[model samples]
Target chain A: MNTPLLTVHELHKYFPLQGGFFTSSKEKCLAVQDVSLSLHKGETLGIVGESGCGKTTLARMIAHIEKPTAGEIRYNGQDIFKFDKKQLKAYRRKAQFIFQDPYASLNPRLTAGTIIAEPFIIHRRNLAQDIDTDLENIMKMVGLSKDQERRYPHEFSGGQRQRIGIARAIALRPEIIIADEPVSALDVSVQAQILNLMKDLQDEFNLTYIFISHDMGVIRFISDRIAVMYRGRIVEMASNQQLFENPQHPYTRILLSAVPRL
Target chain B: MKASPVLAVDNLSTWFDTEQGALKAVDEVSFQLDAGDTLGIVGESGCGKTVLSLSIMRLVPTPPGRYVSGQIALNGLDLLSLSEREMRKVRGKAISMIFQEPMTSLNPVFRIGDQISETIRLHQGCNRSESHHKSIEMLRLVGIELPEKRIKDYPHQLSGGMRQRVMIAMALACHPQLMLADEPTTALDVTIQAQILALINDLKRAMGTSVILITHDLGVIAENAQQVAIMYAGKFVEYSDVKDLFSLPLHPYTKGLLHSIPRIEGDYCRDKRLPIIPGVVPELSRLPEGCRFHDRCPDVLPICRNVEPALIGQGFPKRYVRCWKYQ
Candidate 1:
């Protein structure tokens, strides 16, 4: 509506395939090529693709974890890559990433409470007294009890560990979240629970989501709009209704056909 | 004329003896597959779909896993009665399996062609050059282009879809009576997945090889299998024609699984608050008494919590259910 919340124009990420440090032969691997998309203030954008299809690269570029090789990323009318150290620090407070494998994402040495509070500890040092309250509220919001705060990542089940990851992502009350295959590691029943939780949190916090997943069924459930990526481009992008009901792209139709229906 | 029964698994139970307790990974699972029939096994992870397949092939380690009881008969020969050495001969030649992760399954040290040819040589008692020729043929059957040249390539050089085709080629190398595909297409992309499924269907029809396709995706089941077995908590909740299972899912757990799947059709996702069956499945070691699904079932009754329900129904006459509500 109002110049869209975030705009990505002609974003590109390429990794050079080199022989060795001394070798002159260098071949560039195109990961994300000329990709572009935008999200409203609180809209959920579903990015669907096969493995190595550049969806993850696009998400990382949007989150500013990886700088783009070409094109523009406008976050709130400011170029994300152009931000200096201090401005970048402020931007990190408003954006967070939830990795696919919660078991691997969370440090084995850290407890659930510490993992969730790490962002606040690093960014909001002046408000250190509020960490305890912040930890409890985030825990409850993610459907985890206060007792779980003291436990390590391995002590909890896969589903519970993912809840801790979700809590950590929302710890700073970020305006946008890039969730990369959040529930792909869990069981089907547990996957449903996490999807429902994500939807509830989106409504409660009005957070914009860039959801990436290979599972079409899951993307359809939590996404407002869906973008189907192929080889290295967005083959189709439409509202969830339009994409699911009338997918124009052959790849999108094939993807929809692959998802198991009752 | 219908081909006779190839593999018949009866009341097979696989259990692991742990210090904590005895965990039954596959509890009293039984089914049969005739020639040219694809029986699809659908269930969530940890539901023993893989374990059931492994047990049929006698590949489970005896130190951790014990078959406990039940007969696994393949063409009137009891597989469980055979020695490890004897079973090894029967495996791959008579019954072969293709795993989900093909990269790990294939030996990286060897060429894809050599691997498939090795299997052919071992089972078919052919020369190196003859097996090499057959390997190329198998690759072509799996829809790989220029099998003669591609055979020399390593597993890592191929894409995920191509690696899976190599796995299928190896499984079909000996013209086995039964091929066990354990989520064969799960790791591949959607378009590639369709291609793999179609390849398996074509090969099965042409060779009259019975197939057991184990996957959680019902779409594959619908498009491939003639008979479907729905498993939950290590037991068959429902077994019916694929059409019947899709149209009238009898068990509450089966219904929940089917409903939970997001459909790309009309009016399905209207409910903004996604209908999720509450609570995670209890650990297999600590499964609920009586009906295994009673804990998470929405329509749970007192009797469902106390007594186990039996699978009862004759062929095509009526629906069979375990819940007391049906009674």
Candidate 2:
């Protein structure tokens, strides 16, 4: 409808393969190749793929965590790669990435409160006075108790740790959140809670999500549109209903069939 | 029904002596598997599904873990009473186990062929050459391509799916009567999982091997297992035929779990919020006195908090449930 919130054009990321010291020839692994997608505001775009399908790599490249070897990523109207340092900093503030493993992502030594406030400390330097209040609000918003703020990541259970991760992701109030397998590590019952929390936060903050998971049930539940990736390429992309009901690609069909359905 | 069960676990209780207290990880759990039947143990993490399997395999670490009580009878032989040295003979020959993570389960240092061949040699008492040939055959049996070449490849060189296939091949190398697959496909992709599952089913049918498939996924249990045990907080809260379990789940926890999962095939209402069981699973040391799940149960009763309900059978084709409402 309107100009897409984010536009990716023929994105590619090639990882160069290292050989023995004597070997002179150079080779590369094409992780993501010729990928193009547009994300509308407030709608979740789910990227579904098996491990090593480059879904994570794609997410990282879009988040600017990894530089694309070729092609362009446009945030709003401007090319993200072309942005200057100030604009890049602003872009970083607007787009945040939630990693797969909450245990590994959060620094074990840092207090939950300090981790949540780190983003604001970096992006909004003038907001130092309100950091504590901001951290408290974010923690409360993500269903964490106020008393748990001083605890380290290891103190919390998997679910609570994930809530802490979510708290950190939304601390800066980013418009776009790229969550990669956010609930995969959680138990089934806890997964529902986190999924619901994410949905609620999206409504509350008017957030657009780029949700990535290999679990079909989760992707089906959360996404408006779904893209099925296979071997560094998107084989199918459609509305959730269309994709699930009429998965056109052979790989998508196989994936759908493989999902252990209840 | 007259034939003796291949494996019968009676009142099996596994307790972990933690710093806090004695944690009853698997309490009074009982089940029987026929020669070729598949029994699926479905439960969330920390629900003792893993511990139950580990206990059966005699793989639970001691000092912390202790078999407080119960009998594990495999082919009428009491496994619990057996000496550690004797149990070692039974581990791979009678009952083999496939772990959740194939990557960790496999040794990275050894070639796939060497690992499989080692298992064959250990259990079958075959020579190196015979074991090597059998290893290749095992690889072929599990549907791995280019067995000769792939055999030489290390665990790191294989894909997650292929590694799992290798694990299966190694597990089945000795042709064990019983196979304990503890979330064997959990670490694999859906497509790959399906392939592995199909492979297991095929092997089970061909070899007449009994299987204990452990997973949190109801879908996997539905497709693979003939019987299903719904475990919660270290107890088999419900057990029944898979068809009946799906059609009429008696326990509140089982119902909650079945409803909680988002269905891909059936009529799925996308807008409605998933019905959630409130509260987390109780910590093992400080579990509630009566019902471990009463805190999270939707149909909680006054008696549920005070009196622990025994897992009693419902008169019919054979169904068991542990709940006040069932009583």
Candidate 3:
């Protein structure tokens, strides 16, 4: 209704392949190319593509995990890249990322409590009465038990480890969460639990999400708007129903039809 | 009566003697597969689906894994009774396996041509050039372009899709009667997954090879398999025709799994929180005394906590469900 919470224009990212030991190659692999989209408050933007389609690169650029090779990303009408040190720090607090691999993303040695509390410590945002209280609340918020705080990452199941990852992402109360294939690693049953939990958290916190997955069914379930990427380009972008019902792009149609119908 | 079935697994119980008691990876699992039939095993991780296939191939390690009690007969040949050296003769010749991660399964150091030819030479006892030509033919059959040139490439030289195709080529090199494809497309992209699955289906029909396709995706199973087995906590909770399993799932676990998958077209899953089967799979060792699924199952009765359910077949339309409710 109002101005978009975040707007990306002409976004591009390229990784240069090293030709030799001491040579910087002129040949660069274009990971993302000229992608533009706007995300409003509380909206879930689903990006679907096959592997090596650069959807993850787009997510990384949006979350400020990686700098775009070319383009403009404005957060609340301010250019995120052009922002000064203080502004960049403030922007960091507003956006967070949930990686695809829960196992690799989480620190193995750290307890569940310390992992969730990491953001608070990094941003130095003293949230709530005490750190333990916040930890307990975050754990419960993500459907984890308070008793699990003492356990390491290896002890938790695949689904529970993902919850810990989610808990850490939302601990800072970010405006946007860039989740790259969050549930792809989990079992179907556990995937349901995580998707439901994400929705619940989205409703409660009014958090905007950039949910990326190769799975069409998962993308359709959680997204308000969908973007179909093919070979580092956005082939199509439409609302959830429009994308499913009347897929305009050939790639989109291929993707939709590719999902084995039940 | 019915071509004598390609494979018959009678009460297959593959247990491991772990330090934390015996890990019953597979327990009392029984099923049959006809020639050219695809039996899809759908289960969560650690549900013994992989172990079941390994047991079939006689691939499970003896020090850790042991066959508690079972009869695995492939075309009237008892697999468990065969010695290790004897089993080797049957492995790639009678039965071959395709693993989930093609990258890991395919030897990176060796050329694709050599790898595929090795399978051929080992099983069929073909000469050097003869095996190479046969492997090239296999590659071409799997739809890999320029089989002659591509065969010279290493595993890493090819893409994920190409690598999987290579695996399929290698697995089919000897034209084994039974193929155990464990999560064959789980590591692939959806589009590539579609291609690989279609290729497998085509190859199966042409070669008349029976496949035991193990994966966690219900959609994949529904599309590729004739028969479906729903495994939980190391036992098959439901076994039925593909159409019947999807249309009318019997066991609580099957129902839960079906509902859990978000649909592509329907708005049912969108209206509410995705219906999930709560709680994790209990440890294989030190399992609950009663129904293994009782703790997580909805509509569970008090008796479910105290009673174990045997898999019983329902008359008319051939389906078996292991649940106290069915019992």
Best by lDDT: 3
The TM-score each candidate achieves on chain A is 0.97, 0.97, 0.96
Q: What are the DockQ scores of the candidates, in order? A: 0.53, 0.64, 0.73
* lDDT preference between candidates 1 and 2, better one: 2
Q: Give the better candidate number (1 or 2) by DockQ.
A: 2
Candidate 1 residues A128-169, lDDT tens each?
Answer: 768988889999999998888898999988889999999989
Residues A1-262, model 2: lDDT tens digits:
7889999999999987886688854798889999999999999999999999999999999899899999999999899989999999989989998888888999988998888889988887786669978887888999998889899999888999899889988887888999999999988888888888998899899899999999999898889899999989998999998998888999998888877756
Ranking, TM-score, top scorer first: 3, 2, 1
Report lDDT per candidate.
0.86, 0.90, 0.92
Error of 3 at A81 (Å): 1.1
lDDT of 2 by residue, B1-327 (tens): 489999999999999998899999999999999999999999998899999999999989997999999999999999999999999999888999999999999998989899999888888888999999999999999999899899999999988999999989988988899999999998888888999999999999999999999998899999999999999989999999999999999999998888887667554343556777778888888999888888888889999998899999998555899998878
- Candidate 3 per-residue lDDT, tens place, B68-150, comes to 99899999999999988999999988899999999999999999999999999998887999999999999999999999999
DockQ, candidate 2, comes to: 0.64
**What is the DockQ (computed on Cα atoms) for candidate 3?**
0.73
Query: In candidate 3, which residue pairs clash?
Result: none
Which parts of model 3 have CA positions greater than 4 angstroms off?
A125-129, B268-271
Q: How big is the positional error of residue A197 in model 3, measured in Å on the Cα after superposition? A: 0.4
| Model 2 docking grade | medium
Position B227, candidate 2: lDDT: 95
